[model samples]
Structures are given as structure tokens and as C-alpha cells.
Target: MKPISFIWILSVWMSLDFIMHGASTDPFDFDQVIHFKIEIPDAGIEILRQSNFQRRWPDSSHRPKVKAEVRINDEPFKDVSVRLKGAAGSFRSIDSKPALTINLDSHIKDQQFEGYDKFYLNNSVQDRSYCNEIICRELFQRAGIPTPRATHATVELNGRDLGLYVMIEGFNKKWLKRHFDQIGGNLYDSGFLKDIHANLTVNVGKNPEDHSAKNNLIAAVYEKDLSKLLPGIMRHLDLDMFLTHVALDTLTWNWDGYAMKPNNYRLYHNLDTGKFQFIPHGMDQMFQNPQGSIYPRFRGVTVLSLMRLPAMQQQYFKRMLHLYGTVFKPKQLVNRVDQLAAVIEPELKKRSLREWDRNQRGIQRLKDSIGARGDFLGWELSAPERALKFPDAGFVSIRNWKTSRLRGDIQFRNANENNKQVLVIESGSGINIGRWYSQQLLTQGTYRFEARVRCENVVAAPNDLYGGVRVRASGSRINAVLTGTRNWTWVAADFLVSQPVEEVELSCEFRGMQGRTWFEEGSLRLVKLR
Candidate 1:
């Protein structure tokens, strides 16, 4: 489709183009309210409402779409297809008011609102304040990321008001062209992928039939040499933008982002620079869990790898502190929240008013976060902090043997607790994964190793089989193999440490897809047996 095939399809679409663009960067001006009305056919209404009860997380291509007429302000465009969007968010199982992606181009082919063929309306069910999506996006845009512009709307469907909703500018070529100098490139949607996997879905771009750009990225990820890895990726990625993106992600405490998982992000390969940039999405739950360190060191492979370098860590912290001070202003933000609430106040339902009131009381919450994040991060990165000291067999720091090829992601939870050391394992690809060994050294002797492990949703294909923690020493292993699913069970093994190994590897190794396990606590006692 040609860019600018349509512009200002709805009068409301015009105001969303940032009427206050240069005049003033005020976050919200409630004086200008965009009203949206959608009239769906009875059959289409049934399909849309059916999604309210349907429990499934499918790709947008697989989502059920029905024809409807969407009216922005006074104009009505007919025969649009509306369907649920997002992974868990799309599922009505959790939210009866599921998020929607309306596709006007799908039906009319020639019809589009502005240049956007599609648009996103997210249910602000989680955000009682109904301002996080808007707040975070504005922050990202000001920070120079190609992020969506969000504004609240009073949405009515078939004369039934749906209450307060945040309408996000759809991610497409037209939107990209607006934010970027170069717009022609592949846009890969991360659907439900919490990490960069070989099976990631392609939203837009070349099929990679010959595996051109994606292959180079995968090769960089698996490249063992740190020197070569960064340089290799630098060729295909905008590193500065990536760092800024990572800094912003951690600073905003978006645990659901690419840093923490492989989900809620889009990859745009800029053919201009011959590099890819990560565009942020799913900002509804910003600052949901803020107690976490500003540095998400244990998260995404990209962030983790970058943080591993001293210089990159310094650079990340610098950008984080700068953004916290500059882009994020607590008083200004709270004012924006108030402005948004005030403008949309007339459109709010009475029940929503109560929630909005309740949410407004916590305007101080975000303000407090804004005020604290700078100092908090400053103190965190001010000095070289030492890793927490765990008990003798307290905690384990695990890494894959291949490092580059395939490996399991190991993270220790509650390392300070004496009774138990919980480790969460997100199994990586391939079978020959390295052990999750301890950092401390082990003596030459026989030892009894036991751990309490619980497997949840441990999925495996016919050929794939694995899971469980074991004690390894003297080239021998006493381990428990985990598969299918189970509750907390003790997995024990005895092994002789004939040679004094630098580390006692308590290996809970698993390979294949869709597997998650928790290693709660373990004990290593030197056997007195002669």
C-alpha cells in the first residue's frame, strides 16, 4: 500500500497528529476530546462479544475478525474487521474487555484512517489511572524512539458506551515514516516470544527464505567471543539506540519488555543503516514492579550481553540517570495525569469515575517513583557493588558450556535466605547445555546432593525430553530427568569429587521448548563413607 493512501479519515485522527506538537509539549489537553463510535453488524457484534468469553492466545492472523463500521467523530467508515490483539492481553479469559486491533484496510482495501490501515484500542483495565500507556509512549517519543502516540477516547459500540480507552497509533509503514527518516524495512513482531528464538514470527519484511539479516543476528548471539559479538551486532544494529532503549526500559521498570523477556517488542531493520532498532510496545504496566534494580542484568540476551561489559554498563547507567532527570519529571507527569483525567472526565462512566478518582489519589505514587528513581539508580551504579554472598551451598551461578551455541537461562531468587535458594530456569535450545554450577569451589570427596524441584508446564515434543537437577563430579553424574509436569519433589544424587573442582556444578539442565522449572533448595553434605 502506498504511504499517505489516506490521511485524516476521521476528524479525530487529525487531532491525534499532536495538535500541540511544537506550540507546547504539554502531555494532555483535555479540551480537545476525540469521540469514537463503532456500529457493528449483529453478526459482527456476536463475534466481537464471543471473544469476551473465548480463551485463546493466537497470532493476529489466526484471531477471529468480523466486519463493522467505525466512526471517528462524525464520519463513519463501513465494513471494517475488528479482532482481539496481544497474547495474554488479547485473551478475554483475564480481561472481559479485551484489547482490539481494527483493520479497515482488510475489508475496504482502499479505506484507512489517516495512513494507518489498522488501529489499536487497549483496555485500560489494569491501569486504574488510565494514563500509563499514554505517559510511557510520550516519554519514549521525547527520548527519540519510534514509539506509538496514545490518547484516550470515549468509545461507543452500537450506541453502548465502552467507557475510557487508550487508542495507540498502529505500528506500520506510515507510522514508521513519520517517526523515522528511513521507513522501508522489515518489522518483526515478537508476538509471545520472551526472547529471540529461531521460531519468532515475522510481522513485516522479507521472508528470510535465504536467512539474510536474521541469520546474521542469530550468528552474533551465538558468537562465543565477546569482542566479536559486539562488533558483529554493531554492524546490524543501532547500538546507541539499543542502549538508550534498554536504559529507558529498566528506568521505567517495564518488566514485561524485551529486557526481562522476549515479549512486547518489535524489530525494525533499517535498510538505510543496515541495522535493526527495537521499537517498544505494551506500555500499559509501566512501573508495575519498581523495586527491581535499574539494571536488569539477568534479563534479555542483548541487555545481559551488553551489561556484561564494564563500559556498556557505565554507558547504560549514565543514560538511565539522564533520562530519569530530564525526560521523567515527577511534578510535570502528575500534572499530565491530572490534565488527562480532567479532559476525559466528562466522557467517563460513573463507575469509571470512582476508579479514576481512586487512581488519581496515587498520582503521588508515580511522582514518588520519578523522584526516587534518579537517586536510587545513582546510588546503585555509583560504585562497584558486590554480588550477594550466599550460604555454603546457598546459591548457584549457572552458565551454559557452549555459551554461544545453546544454553539455559539461570537466575537465583531470594539468594539471601538461608533455608532455601530458589533458582528459576528458562530452558534454552539444544541438548548439550552446560551446567548451572556454583561460583565457590568444591573439595575432593564424596558428597550427597539433594534438591527440591517443581516443574510447571514442562512441554516437550515426541523427540524432545529433559529437565531436573543433578550433582556432577569426576566425570560422573547422579541426576533426575524431568518431563511432562509435576509438583515440588526432591531430586537427589550422590557423586564422588575425585578431583578438587573449582566449582560444584549443581546442574539442572533441560533442552527443547516451552519448559519452566524452579529449583527451590538443595543441600550438599560431604559423605562420611570411607
Candidate 2:
């Protein structure tokens, strides 16, 4: 063949290969900073201005979108859809640097910018270091949980530089395709603070029909019998993945996430596996409490239910231990934060020297917190497990309960009730979820928890599932509570321990809008069944 012909043929073959394989690289490249310039017309700017001043969050249906022209790394793209996006902490006015979501294919079908159909530019006001989201997501991904990738970006909107922002992969068909075998499944976004049972916004599939998957999972969670419940849950939910997700969330101290708070998550109905998997989101604030508990009081209904099963609890602990040893390496995480800061600091300096300095301090605090958290979790996980020792009567008078404050204003103290020193959990004129709880380890068996409880002016929150005053034991099936003014009453909850060695938390809880609850400390007893 002629040399010229051979050269032309080789060049054409290389071009085809580039077209086919180049898209495989991540658009949200962790090692690089993306440059984005968004141009919006005056009308679009006005819409943002109006929404910014609204007292309430704009309804999604009413949230107006405006046409925009975007340039990614000097490569221009036209006819994109742009809108302001944020929740409570991160939302900003148009005059300030606002978070934004852009859809490249909103107007022009099949159009994608840098292999991304949709993406988010977060202002990172809640995350001073601008690395929390990226780092947390990376940790989750390392633990085999499918999380959206994130990277740093310098964004300019309508000629106004927005400084440094965290660019994140949006949940959509493309993101699904990258993570799962089945991309056609429904992806449910836990909008704002909603959970699985709520009318979640479907991000990528038909909603009314897709809602059935979540319903099925909820149904499975309601099965009280352990034999039936475990199998039922496994049929509709990926328990293995869910356990790992929870472990990572807990170790990272993601108090605002789904497993802990029933918020900031995505539930995807994997068509291929026919099981739902939770995806973590809004993880900008992490390690805020480095010594936070590895086993927090779960608020998500599904997670709480599973936690009641002792066998499942063992699996969860195993998952946490494995992930901590393998994925939650403190030195490695700190190094990652330093590497990210190196890439981000220069760009941040170009934006504002003062902010850049502040970011350096924030990054140091984050690193310190990461190290502290790793030490705490390692110690907590490695400690020898303890089992409650029973006396000749086969009962133990539970004492030395610690206080746990869930939300709003709450107070716990010892007070004289009927000439006895009783533990009191009082709501300080607001909604509250406070508990005096003690954790005890037990072997597989049936047990009875008994307590004397009293309440005055107790008004339960309409949405509080546990309701008013109650005595609950984790790792068992016990749903009983009391409301309204009542004299000291004897209450008992029978629970069954189903593991060789399982730790269970017994709580004297007051969950209400307003109330003063008293528990006879001397009367609290745990009796092993004959």
C-alpha cells in the first residue's frame, strides 16, 4: 500500500477509537478542576432573583428554568437549562454565589456536556474546605456503595465569577448506567427531608408505578416476625449493600443522611436485582462530631426495623469492622484531603485570599477530626464485648442510664417522685426526642423489660412514630407508648434476643411536642425468661 494511504487509514482508525473510549473517563474528574462559564439572559436572571427572595422554598413544579449558554473548559455549548438549586443551609441568593443545576439536554435532545447530561455546581457554603462531599462519596464508593462522583470547579455565571464550587454528578440515567447493570430502574430522590414512605420525587423513572418498589420494601419492614421479616426484606431490599451503606454512614458521622436521619438519600429500584439500594447525598458536613457514636439512634423506619433483629445487628457490626479496617483508613483519608486541597487552594486563592486562608484552617480541622474519629471508632470496635450478668433472680436492676438528645430543646435530670428519685426527661417548651438509655449485651433468649412510667401535660408530635412516653428495647419487637396526663403506671415490653451475643439499648424515652415524663429509676428491671 502507498504510504499516504496507510497514514490516512491509521489516523481514521485512531479517531474512531478516541470517540468510542474517551467518554469512559469520568466527567467529574477528582484529580482536576473543571472550568464552567454559564451565560443566562436577563429574564432568566430575574426569575432567579424572584426565587431567591421567596420566604419558602419554591415548589419544584413552579421553579422556573431559563435558557443558558455554557462553556466547559473554553468549549462552548448552547441551549442548556439552568436553575438555582439548594436546600436550607446551602441555598444562596442570585446576588451571592448560588448553587445551580444544569441540564444540557433539556432543550436539545441527546445533547450532553462533557459526557454529562446533568450536573450540579454546589456553592459549598456549608463545607468550608469544599472537600467533604467529594471525600465522603469517595469513602462510600470504596466500601462498595454506589455514590455519585464529585470534583472541584471554578464557575462563572453571566460574567460574574462564582469562585470555587464543588461540581457533583447528578442522579440520572447516565449516572445509573455507570453504577448499575440496569439503568431503566426508578431512582427516587428523598426530596428535602422526606423518606421512602413519603411521596418521593422520581428522578429517572415512571413514578406512580415505580412507587410500588418502595411500598414493597416498607411492607417487608413491617413484618414483625424475624423469620418472615428477614426473608421478606431480602426479597425487596439489598440487605448486604444496605448494611455496608449504614456502616460507612455511621463511621463518617453522616448524621444528616438517610440511615441516621431519613434524609439526603436516593432509593433506586434495581430492575436486574429487583431490590432497592440506598444512595448517600448531601454529605457536606461530616466529622462534625468525631467522637459521635458508631451506633446512633436510627430514625429511618427501615433501618430501625432491621436493627431490631439481633442477627442483622451482628452482620452490621461485621460490615462496620471490615470497612473500617479496609476503607476507613485515617492516614489515607487525610492524605486525600491534602491532595484535594492542593488542587483547590490555588484556585481558591485566585478568588479570595482571606477565604483561601480560612479554607486552609478548615482543611486542618477536617484532617484532625478525621484522625480523631478513626481512633474513636477503632477503639469502640475493638473493645471486648460485654454481656449483662444476671443475679440468682435472673433479673438486673438497670441503672447508670445516659442522656440522649435527639432534637429541639430537651432536659434530663433526677427528680423526687412519690419520695423516690426518678429520672425525668422534660421537653423545654418545644418538640423533643430525649431518652435515658443504657446498652446491654445479651445472649439468644427471651427477655422482659419492665418500668414504671408517668407523664404530665404530654402532647405527642403528630408525626412522631414512637409517640409520647415509652420504654423501648433495641434488637427486639416492642411497640408500646403512653400519652397525656397519667399516674405512675407499670409498663412492660417483651423482646427476644436472636444472636449469640448482641448488644441492645434500652431507652426510657419521651418523644413529644411538649411533655414532662418520669421513669422510676429504681423500678427499671430486665428479667431473662425461664
Candidate 3:
């Protein structure tokens, strides 16, 4: 054979061999294999003031009904069972209730796809239908926490494989009536859940004119005017319940819980007494640790998003921290972590073995599609240390300001280079370095502002060492000047707003002087004065 022909034939043979036997490498597919569609219609439930109902007839009001259409892989399963549950099982069984099933084999064929056989189970055992959800709730309850009962269903498809679905009872009228009768009417409106215009048209609210008519029981309670009711309601709610869930949630960094909309959180209210309760619900454990920061699936937006709105941001952070502290007391938090570790250890062992077998089967089925173990499925346990700490408050940034040139050099700098960064107010002439001072704004009353200011040796003028932070509100500006100081010192001032101001600006203005200056650890707070 000619040399060229021999080489060509050899190359072809090598190509065939490589195609026949090559190392398979690919990433795991995290995409869902089965699709789920949930339909929650309006007009199925009604909410009322817990104090309106008469005593001794708590069960008189009718319970709200729910219906859902579930589809998997474009096929509908008829004869699938559905389950429901609530705070009380004695009045009525919320488990394994029967539901109507519709077969969708014809529908799939109509769509030009392979036909599939599906079954529906409406009446299902609460324990079986929502096994995982029940376990989570049970764990919280065992830890003396408050959580709604988990109701679930299991469906048999083709008499071979099984699928699961869970249904959680809403803290609607029925649940609230029972609890409210026991406790006197005391409730506060939940800021997180409020009434919407659309819910009103659906008759979700008891009264037509009440702005809070469609608000969930939790929100209603939160919005309640009586201050006395809050303490009792908060007392009844198992703080331990919240802590257990939060601890588990922190471990998983459940982002999904944060993503749920207003009505998702379960609430309780009594028509007779007008009392209220709120509880967290509906969680699917999925999280992503980005930049070593655990981002739960439910926390759709970043923490920075809240910081943009200064007033709301301050209130939100303060409220969140207070709640966290209330639920997880220092000693209690440590103990809860130990309990969680105990639970997770055993579960982890079982999961390791099961996951290994599943991975093998999945690899065989997909062939080269199984990627790195940590690539898409590994769970993160701890977040970076910095993420666990509190973030600083300051005028983060400003644009198109009157003193843009003088304030141009002002930038944020890290105090410790390893710790959090602080705003660096650079020294320049004829420019006022302004920061949109973000402290809690008073809706009604007087407030005092104070800060510690220091002058460095690099400052050019000693007599002209005149620079002060200004507090501006509604066309009124109060200036507190710092003078005759070559080192860090404290400066204070007071301001009165005849009317409410949504926000206030804090600025350091340098008049007719140029040199470097350092400002650090600035603070502004609001206090009510008689």
C-alpha cells in the first residue's frame, strides 16, 4: 500500500476507536425532570375579624375549600389523592380527604406526544401526603415551636413509581375562630402581609371599606390597634418553634422560604375576640452559597436591596434583629444548634448511601452527563464570618450633587482592610461632602443628632478648622460645627420637625480650606421626648 493511503486508513481507524471508547465527562443536570403546575383560584376562602363571631359556636362558620390541578411530564394523573390538615383534628379530619381526578391521556395525544397514564389521589393521609413537610413541622413542634400541620398525598403512577404532594391548610377563618375564642381579642397587623385591590373584588375581606379586609390573619393581628394583645399573642406563639425552624433553615440556608409572597405565611384569628396569630410555612429546602454567603432560595433579593430605602431599611433591620434575638437567645441558640446537629448527623448517614446509589443509576442512564459531586448538588453548611455580622449604616453614595467636585474624592474605605468598610470623607475646598443620613425618621415628634468628629494633623487651617455635619429636613437645615480640634472629638446637636420628613441628609461642609481629614464611626439616632 502507498504510504499516504496507509496513514489515512490509520487515522480513520484511530478516530473510530476514540469514538467507541472514550472517557465520559459531563456535569450533572440540576434541571427538574418533572414539571409541576399549581392552580390556586380566588373566591374559595373568606376571612373575617376573629372578634366578630359569638362564643360557644366557633365551628358554625364554614371551612374554606381548595382545589388544585397537578401535571407531571405533560401527563395528568387521575385518581391521585389529596390531603389537608390544621391545628385541630377533633372537629374534622383534615387528612386523606377524597378529591376528583381527571385523566389526561387524551390531552397528551392531542398535543402530539406520547400518551401517559396518570392517577389522582385526593383523600390522603396527612402524614403520607406531605412527609417531608410534616417532618419539618414535627421537628419544629417538638422543639416547642409554632408551625402549621403538614398534609400530603402519594400517587401511584403505572402501578410502579410513586409521586408525592403536600397541602398546608391556610390560617383562614375556621382555624382562627377556634383559637380566638380561647384568647381575648388582641392582634396586630403584620406588615409583611397586606390586603390587595384584587383580593377585595374576590370578597376576601369581611368589610368592604376596611383597607385591611383582605389582609391575612397574621397581618390583621399585626395591624390590630390594641397594644395589650401583642404581648399575649407573642407569648402563646412558641419562640422555640421559630428558633428550630430558623436553625434548620440556617443550616440549609432556605432561600425559598424568603421568596414566598404575602399570603403564604399561615395566620390565626378569632372572630369572637378578634385575636390573631402568625406562623411561617411552605418551605422547600434549596439554597445557594454565593461568595461564601448562604443565600436561601426564598430570599430572592440581596440584603443591599433593603438598604436603598433608608427609613424602611432601618425599621426592617431593627425588627429582624429583635425577632432573631427574641427567638434565639444566646444560650438557647447554642443549645438548638446542638439539637440540630444530632438530627442532621443520622440523616446525613442515610442520605450519603442513598445518594451514592442514585448517582450511579443516574450516570448509567444519562451516560457522561454525571458531573462533579460538588458541581451542582453539594450542600453548604456555614457562611463566611463577615456575613454573620451586622452591616454598617451610612450615606453609601450620591450622584449629581451641587458640590460634586469637592465631594468627588470622597470614597468608601475599609477600616481594618479585613473588616467592614467605612465611608471616607475626603478633604477638599468649596465642596460639602453630603451623606443621605439614614436613621429612623420620626413620623411625629422631636429628635437629637450627634456624631464624633476628629481632625488630623494633615488639616491645613487651625483657625479655619471649621467643618460641621448638617441635618436637613423640609427646607430647614441645622448645622453643628467642629472647631479648635486637632484630634477626634464628639459633637452634638438637636433638630425639631414640625411635620414628618421621610428622610434627612447629613453632610460635612468645609469652608475656604483644603487638607486631608478623617471621619469614622458616625451615628445618628431618634429618641422620643416628652
- For all candidates, the clash counts are 7, 0, 57
Question: What is the full ranking by lDDT, best candidate first?
Answer: 2, 1, 3
lDDT string, candidate 3, 1-530, tens digits: 64568888899888876675443311001111233343323322121111122224433433343433445444443322222222221122221232323233333332211222222233222222122343444444544444544433333322322333343333333333433445323222222223221221211234435534224323423433444333433433332333344444543234344222332243333344243333545443222332222222223121222222344333433333444344323234334333433333343334365633443343232221112212222222111221112225422222222222345344333253224233334454444343433433333235445544554423334454344433333433445554334565555445554322234443434432334444444343333332
Q: Which stretches of candidate 2 lie over 4 Å from their true place?
A: 1-25, 52-62, 206-210, 385-530
TM-score ranking, high to low: 2, 1, 3
Supply candidate 2's per-residue lDDT for 346. Answer: 85
Q: Which residue pairs come into collision in candidate 2?
A: none
Question: For residues 1-530, could you state the per-residue lDDT of candidate 2 as single tens digits?
Answer: 64578888899988886776653556565378889999988888898776542335424523568899999888788999888887778878777988888888889998876688888899999889999999999999888888989998899888998899998998888888888787777888887777688888778874536477788898899888878998999999988999998888899999999888888899999888989999998999999999998778899888888988877887887888899889999999999999999999889888899999999989999999999999998877864355777889899999888999999889999988568989998898668888999988776678988999889989988877777888888966646789999998998888887654568899888888887989999999999995
Better of 1 and 2 by lDDT: 2
Better of 2 and 3 by lDDT: 2
Candidate 2 matches the true fold with a TM-score of 0.72
Model 2, CA-based lDDT: 0.85
User: What RMSD, rounded to one decimal, does every model reach?
Assistant: 15.9, 10.7, 19.8
How far does residue 448 in candidate 1 sit from its true spot (Å)?
Answer: 33
Tens-digit lDDT track of model 1 for 1-530? 75653554665565765564634432233334566788767876666654542224333334568877788767678888787665555444212456778777776766865456667888776666677888888888888887877887667777776766788877766677776677656677776654664456666554444347866876776678878877887887799888888878887778788888756898878877888889999887777654677645456777776655555756776787677668866567667777776766666546476756766655556556655654565555433333223355544433332122244443333342346666555555433343444433444345555566676666554564333433443344535576667877776567654322224444544444556666663443223222
Model 3 worst lDDT window (10 residues): 24-33
lDDT accuracy of residue 303 in candidate 1: 72
- Which candidate number maximizes TM-score? 2
